[model samples]
Target: MLHHWYISHHHLYIPPSMTIHHHHHLLLLLILFLLTPPLSTSQNDTVSCPLNFDLLRRLVGSNRPSIDSSTVCRYAQQALRLVESDHLRRTSSFVPPPNTAESCWTAYQAVSDYFYPNFDLRRNCGFQTNWITVPGCMNITNRQQFENKISNSSLNAVVSACNQSLTGSSCSSCTVALSNLQASYLNGESVGNLTDCRAYPFIYAAAFINQLGPTDRGTAVCLFSLSINFSKSNNKHKTVIIVIVITVVIVIVLFGSAIGFWYSKRLKKLNRKRRKKAEINTVSALDSYTGSTTLIRYTIEDIKEATRNFSRDNIIGRGGYGNVYRGVLPDDTEVALKRFKNCSAAGDGSFAHEVEVIASVRHVNLVALRGYCTATTPFEGYQRIIVTDLVKNGSLHDHLFGSESLRANLSWPVRRKIALGMARGLAYLHYGVQPGIIHRDIKASNILIDENFEAKVADFGLAKFAPEGATHVSTRVAGTMGYVAPEYALYGQLTERSDVYSFGVVLLELLSGKKALLSLGDGQPVLLADWAWSMVRNNTPLEVIDGGMAECGPPEIMEKYVLVAVLSSHPQLYARPTMDQVLKMLDMDFPVPTIPERPMPLVAGIEDIERSVSSTGSAQLSTPRGYQAYTFEMDVRLASKEEEEGKC
Candidate 1:
């Protein structure tokens, strides 16, 4: 009886009612085929594959059992190495001969008979459609590429139309079965006039590999399959040996990878623990400086969200310390969020200083300390954040010496008002507060101004409080270069006078319309104070006055300003007027006493308040107020009245 058999993949499907005779014949053909390898360990010899049926029989020999002629032809067609790489190479090269169809058919049969039974073949090979057209097949260059497209493409949906149809094991089994079928065909196995089914798949796989360039990572998988060839009687043994070797190698790789992964994970966990411990230690130290106040921790997420995710568009300014971003609070109040460098050497201390000083202090002239946030939220990489009231109109430095348009617009009256406001702010910092806070850094930049030209002392990050009876504070020298006091800058001796000196520098900057550090040619560094002093000494001080001041204020008013600047910027610490003295000078409420003409007191107060002023004549207080004038006559009169009252 003649029967039709078609091999789709590795499966060898036979139709029902093929007859018991065919079944017996098929089983016998499988059992007695001389293509089977010997059990002995000695045979490692290579044998050529049969190009025809006569050659196939000659290879099987007389000791082999009877095998079907068609099966023989199929085996021969499927026995060649269609996909292979050099022994050392892991990647596969898919270069096909002119007759790709013949080779692919042989590959199909090889894989089919080798891995799967007839039933599996019947189910998968139900359709003999043009599975891999050149265009469709060549598109998949690598295994990963193929798997990716297949997952999203109709191939995956149609291949197993049902939901949850395949597990990992089942999928691997299917791949193996299909691979065997393809191998069988590529081996030159033929069925009737259909040529070999397996050879076509190999050609298809090869065509794809060719397009993906040699450097493609996926080509290794295709080459992996070609390393094993089953042709001689002992080929089965060789195949088994190779499979065992591959399995052992795979197991070793998997084991090593597992160990490596475990170590990496363990190291990561240890690092996390160490980092957590370090953070806890740091928080503990920071808390020591804070009293009765709970530090508000802000998660990185909270900060990002609060600052609109630290958007670059929201950035207001950048300083030596860190960038300042604009943030809107939950209540819709805008604030300037100063972010400190995470890895900065002084970030922790600076944060502590700002929080400690700003939290407890409240003053109108001082920038109101709103609130701050630390590592309070679950966001990543956000640790230190400080929120302060947003000062609009930018910094005082901007208005004093900003763009030409800005400077021209700042009237002399406004400039004087800003200077007065700044003085009051410093006065509050120096003595107005209960604990007497000293602003370590007092510069134009630190003085923020509002639209109304109201000066607010800002950036108290370096501020310190003077303890009772402490004349000077010993600290690490920290301040802007030019504004830093010579005493503190040279010898780390911080005192209220240091701020006086810095304020003096700012006053000079204000009057001169130039930075405190300026150059006037001749290699002479024209420090604002020295230049202004020289101008005053030469009586040409009006030339140094800001032109804006020149236009708005009276010439005489500018001369008084020159006097104020000279008094404010006295080189000697004792000579410099106190913040209170400066305020009085600005307001002109106190009289300008005549100097001694030779050597006079650097600081002259209201000692000669009631005395008349005369040029070149020294003023004296003959009987100052609150001094007792003892008179015996007035005492005797009071005693007589007392005696009379007692007698009555």
Candidate 2:
């Protein structure tokens, strides 16, 4: 016919004009046929979860029988991992789709093959594909809710408790807590078929391990295996267990005794070496100073008898350095024995060498060293001991601002005398010695009061001696907060002036009956120096004196003492007077100078503080450095630029 065209299985016919276009279409079809993948390969690539044959083999152990319902969950977990890891493992160049899934048949087949010979694990053990992410009891509404609930539970704490210790026992509290967590939140009670309920613990462990550490995974997996404990009750086995236990105990006793004996001998040898080293350092340091006081070496037994085995009742005072205990010496002398808490070998050397510092100095106003003892005991380690005459009154801090019963003992005259005595003691350390000793920790607590209420400067653990002709020794800053001088606190440039600055703070404390560091209304710390100076600069000097002592002394005398304290604690290092100069100021041998108007402290971190200061005019923040209190000052930098310029 009419220009006949035919399309058949083997042949196609077209009119001569359209024959060229037909050939092009046939060529395009041939290219696609060559590029297309085989059916099997495409099927393999499409399966979201591919269970490696080797991984399945490892999951079902060779040692065990084909699993029960509880055991089959372990196999289910291995199959579930492929899905979870895919979520983390990328499929394309970098970014991937947020979620992925697979045919339930894929998971079912691999998990079935895991127990290879017995492939019908579901019928035998009642396992299912949906049990992958959570236990059967927790009926989750959505994917997000499931994730949120598990995350909120934070099973780490409970799981950590169940971690087996060296003794091969786990925390009972852990078991109880975990049980409660399951009951309350996880709905751990069997609510479904018995087979699914049996599968819950294993699935629960699998979900929890994904969130926990690797070390905890082993413990978590065994939770159910260990929990399935069966108690065998038989009279015959009870006798056998008791006999086995006795034999094991006997063997362990013999082995342990040998180890303990060897350890004790080794410890004794090490302690002897430390004791000898400490002695040499003590002798060498003491020999250099040719003072009249002798460091009498006492025995450890004598010390123990003196302090009644270091009884708690005998504890007279305690500080950051050590505890001071009251003891009666064999010679019928009452002594205060300072037992340092530092039992380390390095600490032994320090306290040993320092025994000569305050011990060698003989002054009525200074706590003289009666004697010192260094001994080693099997139990108490190396004992570095120092003996001194006991001061009946605890400390200047005790009477002036200590407990109420102690505070009553201090009248205005007594406070004045104590202040004078403290100045004398510090003066002796600074000027009386050939090489001046800087009492770096010169605070009210360090100044002990005797029966006569005389203040004796004590606790020379942080003392440093000025080298000949050196103005300031650049050393580590060691002192209390609210008392450290500007140069020493910021730059660690220490000198005799650092001690004077501390003394000034103590003097201020004595006058105001306020602590050197005062906590304000909002728990902000205001230094006594700042508060006292503010009153004196405002012509209300009497306000700085203790309200109780307001009428005890002439207002003029009190005002003079207040002015001297302010002068001695001046922020600038050079502006601070030496201890000798301070002594004369207290004695009125030198007149009180004109009061200086203190500007905002131009010390370290003041700029950051100025920037951080809010509308409230005070801010609590960390210190750039550390001292006693652990926090820096806000009152120190409260004044603004305009105010500082106006006051200065």
Candidate 3:
């Protein structure tokens, strides 16, 4: 009966005597059951011992008669205890201990080994294989993809529970735990404890049973234990490789930092050397102008501090030369600072030339040069700055046509006064100085009005001295387009007459209240000089007068002033009056000179003359009586035609 019972239970036919002799197998099984530990009382325990014996019986099968049912029970019991203990430790009410994620992952690996001892975990587990290792489980390579998968799986509930229960500090502790697990797994270490492994038993069972092979149950169990040891050996090798990589990275970072520091220091030293060289050049340049007692030398630092480091708000004007900043001196004197544009040798020459010219001249109508500065700083390299008196009323161009407020204040008498003051200043520049100076750029914009409504001619950057016994200085043309005289613009022959001609253009602009260059809305620009000349030639000089003028004194005086302006701006350089004669005409010092007939060749328009002057600074001259002779020739030809018709 005992042999029959063994055959029925084990599904094997064993002899009665063999069963009697191996009766100790039952006793050994009993002892094994007695040695197994009981389950913990923790509420968070995931596995309970004494698992379904029927399920274990089916999983092991009756292939080996040497192994009894008790051994299978013992192995299952041990695995359950490990799973239960790990779950309890992980879900403990205290703060998470170190290596919690690693511990959880190892428990899951152990469960996988128990279920599928000889099967490849990656192949058999399908998508569930990642749960066997923390690095693979976490999907560190693509976190969003992992998250999306988790959201669609049963594991989502576990993640939601952790998020809902954890505070910010606890969450950070959890993150550290996960990071440690990932690091260990990357080094091929098996996590010893994994709390979430309890949830994957069903998945593991499904994959394990699908690939189960007919094998000895004892050997299968032994292989699972050996795999754990093998994993540990591989973990040590991976750890060594990881350590070497970290050390190499640290050494490289230290070397790179040292190189960066050395490069920074060398760059700073080079900048210091360049700055010192610039300062030396600046000092040498200023020394050349020290012989002049009138010129005051200033340092770059002083100008910067006075102008608030050249702030945009301090800028008063901008032109082709550069920006004009309003600044205050150490002596509490307000001044206009003209910072030049170019920093080349040509710019330096202009700066030095201007200093020499303004420093020598002393006239009320001319702008006073208070001081000068040459700076070569690291930021603004080799700068040339000129300081002049800050005119309160701004430029003549501003008052004549700028804003309505300015025009309202500038009465006709004030305009006449400004006109006379400008004439006096130019006359002084032409005749009062021994060698004389020709202001090549004489326009309304350059004429500044003072606090007392007096005119002061500023910007001597273009001024040149007329040498003794020389009629004109031949040089490159440099002046505003419409204001340049025909002789100077065409032939590059700069003379006192050229300046007189420019003044005449300004005078005409003032009288007519029009810009020197006027856009006629016909794709052609007309010169104020030509327009005034045409008005005078047509016997309508008063028509050219600005209607904005309130008190023009007398029509006769105004007309005479207009006639003098026209005669001074004649196309023929010889026909134009001198600065002295211009002043006399403005003051009614002598009768207005006879207005010459319009030169027929000169009637080609100002635009044409400008084009010709720009190309070659001289125009082809016509005879003094060229216009009269042409008219006479036309009349004689007409008379001959009339006599022929009468004969016919």
Candidate 4:
């Protein structure tokens, strides 16, 4: 022993060379010293911090050799809570002291060493490759898994784990570990396998202890380490499996694309055959109606020449159904050609027959239908065309609220004349026709003006015939939203009064120089009819007149006209006047009627109106009075004006 000895300043001596057996003995002594817990001042004095054997036993039982990321996170959270609770209980305060992190780290290290004698924090826990790296692991499913694990754990196990992690010199390391574990859990970071317990073995143990409670601590430790080692060894196998899966996916995509292309081609051929059959049927129907003289059937070539192959420059109007283009015939007669898009030949042929009957309807205020053409082309497929007299001044909507040039030309007198003409035209459709035609859509856009500014009612596509003895037709509700009559819109009850209601809305628009639907910066949009009614009910009918129309007519005359508009647009089907009656009131042929108090049922908000209008194809309301009322209100102001002018 004295062969070589070294002495330190502290007076401790060590032999420079020792026997192998002696060296082994010295290592055992050092090991025993490190394993012993720190001593208290008195031999009988109990250590203030004791290991929570019950918690460790529970954690060991619950833990699986291999666990998912969610299970790891749940265990981590439980360990942190236990540590926090124990800290508060011992300190008698909720707030953690400054040395809390150090204490937590120390406790965590001690536990790790106790569980796995050869545990390496950096090599096992710090290596990123050892953990699962799935993207979006913090999503709903992961959170749900965490909740389930916690819910299934024993309460005692959770409390014991927390207490153990918060006590003794080991507390500093445990506290630090707990904080790290909590952060990782919240962010949905993955914990490695059992052997590589990810810096917090106590947390991992606490989570699964209930499930693995029967296993001895030594066996649990051995199993955890083995599982981690096995996982590490399978890295190459995982890479191979991933490559195979990617290759299979590429094959699937290629096969799907090829099959889709073949199916698409077959569909196109079938569609072509169907289109050809439809075209033949349409031609046969047209030949049967060739005797009708009202509509002149033009050749496809003639239409093409007239419309300049449907040039974009010639387009005057565009709508959901089709486009209207200006065309010049070989005879120098200019016409408006409406080319319907996405129409089948059978549909076009039926429409042409209807056009033949509508063409027979001749009136000064109605746009004349010149001819029609139905054909198939190589590039454009089936074509449906309706030719009418070209009106240079465009639609009434264009002049009333269109371009500046058009508005400038529509003087107050011109506007009044246009309004009167529109009334007379609608009157002709509702009363003059043999089987009365109800123009389904009667907005300003349908009323066209010629070069002379005369109103020509057009667009009879949506019109329906009012047969003899039928007060109302039960057809599909179709029209512009704001201008649709509540009776017809809500119930699809198409009566002559429906047209009357629409005309009333238009009349209000004329009086106010506003759109049929007016937005006043409020939540709900105001219908022109509703706004006019409100003004009249408030006894401020003069306020409803357009400012630009101040010089259009006298206040008394304008007020009377506004009253006529409101009375005609009354929401009740029975309350609205007939189109003929509307014309008479506007022309001063009949006295303006006293607008009755709007029926309580009609004073609904905009949402109610929309709901009623959209509830088409449902049960309809009963028919109201089919006859028009003759009773009128004698306005004192109008009577005075008449007295002075000597025209009453």
Candidate 5:
């Protein structure tokens, strides 16, 4: 009779066997029987064993007839007991086959040895280890691909690469890999933990387990469920489904939160922009516009041609509107063109207002306004064309101490005359006109001098229309950096005294022959007024005079000029001497001391300069002195007197 081996939920059964003596076959049967329970609990239905019959027939067919059925059956029973002893679950009762157990055991052993012992496998078996490992694990779904890579890499090297130590507390890389592993599984992506062998071993393991191949029996059971009760095996399907659903919910919540945060920030930015726009609009609406005489328009092309295409070479000076360019008209008359900035909307309005106010008011000491180009073009947005009479000697800054030659010629008498001319121009703006205009941005740069070295106050872009009803104009404050008064800069108050304060700074610059602000060796900023005030308070006022200036005049004259400048430049506006007070100072007399040449430190070629001027312009240097003047080297003279006068 043929023998058989049977496996069921209740037990493993070995049938009585025919005699066969094959050592390898006997060992195979023993191993298989050992892997299953000898006794079976009555959990399900039983079946007859076929292993006894198959083993007997194969042995006889191979001409091996020495094996005994009783011996095989006994070996199978012992192996089954050993396997059952290792299992954590209890054994159950089952029916035994009639054939010898040896035959069934041999058959079972052959199949078990074929698949199990050839590869390394690890079972967690209720341990705390991160993952379970399996070896020689053939895939039922993708067997060929897995086997190909297995031969390509050494077993230990592949294992070692995956089992690398994490080593550090910073686990951001590990966390990202874990997230990607989970996301890929949820997305139905092909993931194999061991196959990919990512840097993180555990993440790779998770993917591997997820994609593992089912056994042959598993495939049959799984396929049958498709036709039968597919939803019955919750363990086989529901775990992955739950993970996918949770992942989707998390992604949706995160996306919604990100969008909400972005919208909130965008709303705040929009609100801030709206508030700023409203503030600017209110200021523009409240701006007084009654003083404007007429509105004019000009193309950018026309203005460019007038000012040599806005060339740097043509820039005589700069103002709030833009650069003042020296240009000549088609009528052969010279014109001072004030080109307003293309980007400045507020400046455009002020430029128009200046043209109206300056064009109507005529004064000899103030720079004369002739014509304007209110240039408007589709390409340029807006442009201002201001035509004024050109002064030949550039600004007062240039003539005072600008060139080696000019400083030599800037004798005491000439400086006094320039001071008086500046006073007269300021007085006219302060009290001489219809509605006294304050030249808000008063500085050496704004004061133009003719070839004869007369001061002409210019740049009234910051000028305010002070009429009967207005006590103060609530407007944006504007002035040059060092010339700005502290109160005006802080409060945006427009008044005539603000102009006086800036003029005082200009006066201090004149007295010291230094720029209003200077950076010293230790990076300290020294304003000219503060430095001069220090000298004045120390009673060493002559120390503040320019080297070239010190030698050109007597100590007594220099002292008087220093006192006037210091009084004008006092920090408090009320403490400052007015232009009228300044004029009186120029006319006042003190006992003339034996005016000795004051000593001074050497500036660049100042010693040579003083030696030269003392010899040549000695006669011209003998007059009484006034406020000191800062100087520059750049000559801003227009070529001809007729051209200059015609432009004004």
Candidate 6:
């Protein structure tokens, strides 16, 4: 049997499957292969590729006025090095960046100067480009796409066969696998390119190595670097042993260095955390001074100094989750700083939500956020604070029920203005805003009063945004007991109407100068909502007006305010008027809807409202377009005054 032989680059290659006896005859084969002139074949047939040095040397020698082959080969070698340094590079997988076809054009032209003027090298361009663009069939940019085209087992086999450290049968297997892999892509179904190009084993290895990472590139380059004599692979004992020993030493040093690096990083991280704690513990106190008035995220140190280190004397208002301090900022601007009591994650979540809501809204009737601070320290744990412009007259609750000294003789006209201002604030939250906000904690305390007694709604920590087209958002109840709507307080069913109900309770307090929960001789507290409704139902609405007002209003106006409050705080969910309706009724642009008959059990908890709602099955509530009363029909005895003023 006869076997064909070929000289591939400097290394002579034979099919791994072919067995040759008496290797001494191989010398004759090499002589015959090099002595033969270069030849070409069709793309499908086996094509003989030239050696890198020999290809350039032969081109120069083939010229009529033959230039030095050695000088031309040197230029080609330099050109090959520049190709790797400049043209071939890693790129983003999503976008395949432009690769100038000129890169291949330039490398060849760099060595083409030695050719005879009449004999240009353009015809051998494709063959010459293949010299540097080995394994050119693969697309490195779309790695996942390229890898998906080949089977996993075949790819793994190819990788192992082409390992740089391997030789002999390994090299033969690699060559065969590479040909099959290369041929597989030539059927017009490849990733980067579909057509076949002639390439020797060394050039083929260079193209493949371009796609590999550093270590693999080096190892694989070694595979092509070796001029392996298949018959004599076993004879390179000293070389193989040296390669194995070097690989082992390099790996050991790498592993030891990696372990040391990991420990170093961990130690630095621990030290950083420890240093942070120390810094917080020893943070120096800051001195107060006038500075720029521009609002910014004030640091925790700035807050402490401004509030006199949170002295009790500085505290102006106290609430459920935080305390408000009357502070003079560095700019000499007066601000009410609220420092939260709870520092847990849930508190931070609420703090973030409050900031989000406060930041989104901007209205004259709403408290403006001057600045806020969030700090984490070992001493205070987590500090969440917000600063707002200090209301000159304090909160509505302070004027209405606070000590007499805080009260500035509020006349009925001023009271009415305050009432209208509060209505406008709640109205904006309900109607003007998209996905309206529900001021869940709409009570006297959250209603701040300015020097002109203009109401500014404050404390949005308990507020919730009413989603568009949503009837209600069921959530855990989060409002003050007296101000909380019956449905939300009991069932956790929240809606914009819940805020309307809370607003009604606040309205009654403003109109009557009474607390939301009016305490009688009995231990049970009565809802001011029921008491006002009972008085109005008895045709004695004037009795609900606050007598302490500087001046009394017209009977009709007083009666109208009383009627609006009763309807707004109506126990039945559908009976209560919305803030928009309340505003219209307050301004007397529209008549107050008839007082909805609240059921007898006024002393019951929020659960009583649920029962009242079920009783009015499928009853849709609607407001009159103008000065006409829309009446709600109900059959029930009104709760006694004693019962109305009992437990909420």
Q: Which candidate is the best by lDDT?
A: 2
lDDT of 2 at 97: 23
lDDT of 1: 0.53
Give residue 229's error in model 2 in angstroms.
Answer: 71
- Candidate 5 lDDT for residue 202: 28
Per-candidate TM equals 0.47, 0.52, 0.51, 0.51, 0.44, 0.48
* lDDT (C-alpha, whole model) for all candidates: 0.53, 0.60, 0.59, 0.58, 0.49, 0.59
Mind giving the per-residue lDDT tens digits that candidate 5 earns over 1-648? 445655555454555453455445755776776777666465453333332223222211322212122123222222222222111012111112323233333444553333233221212112111111111122212323433444333323333322332211112123233334433332222232221222122222222321221111121111111000111335447689879989999999999997998799898878767645644553343233322433234455656777778889988876433577888766777777876564333344455567656865667789887656543357765455666788978886775548877666666666766777877888777678778787777878888878888888987766777665554454554566567554354345565666766776776666667877765576755557767776776789898777776345677777887777766665434345556667677666733212111211111122223333433211111111101111110011111321222221
What does candidate 4's lDDT look like per residue over 80-173, in tens digits? 3344323333343222333333334345546544334445433544523212211122321222343433333343333343334221222222
Over 567-597, each residue of candidate 3 has an lDDT whose tens digit, in order, gives 9887656467788888887886698866644
Error in Å for residue 493 of model 3: 0.9
Candidate 1 residue-wise lDDT, 181-295, digit = tens: 3433233323322223333333333333234321222221131111111124475786898799999999999999979977998888787777566556556755663445544
Model 6 lDDT, residue 423, Cα: 88
Report the lDDT tens digits of candidate 2 across residue range 1-648: 354565444445666765677668866765665566545555556435432334333433342222334334444443334323232222211111212123443555664664445556455556543333232344432334434555445466555554343011232234334544553455445433221322332234333433432113233223322111112347588789889999999999999998998899999999879857766665565545434556677889899999999999999987555678999988799999988665555565457546757765779999888777766678877677788888897888787776777877777788889989998998999999978899888888888988888899988877887798975687755666677775566456787888888898999999889998887686866678877877886889889888875337877777888888898887545356678887888886688755433423111233233334442111111121222233253223322311221110
- Better candidate number, 2 or 6, judged by TM-score: 2
lDDT of 6 by residue, 1-648 (tens): 666766674578675656556254776777876787656555345332211222333322332223233233332333343233222223312222234233444534544554423223434322344334433344333345555666766666667666454322233345546555644542332333212221222233334533442223232323222111111224378588879999999999999897997899888888767645643432221111112323357788989988999989999987556688988887799998988775543334556566666766778899988777767778887677888889878888888888876554667887888888888988998888786888777888889989877899998877788889876787865666567665565456787778888888888998888988776676655678877876886889989988877788888988888888888887556567678888888986698754533422101112222334454311111111000010112202112311221110
CA lDDT, candidate 1, residue 97: 28
* Superposed model 3: Cα runs more than 4 Å off: 1-288, 602-648
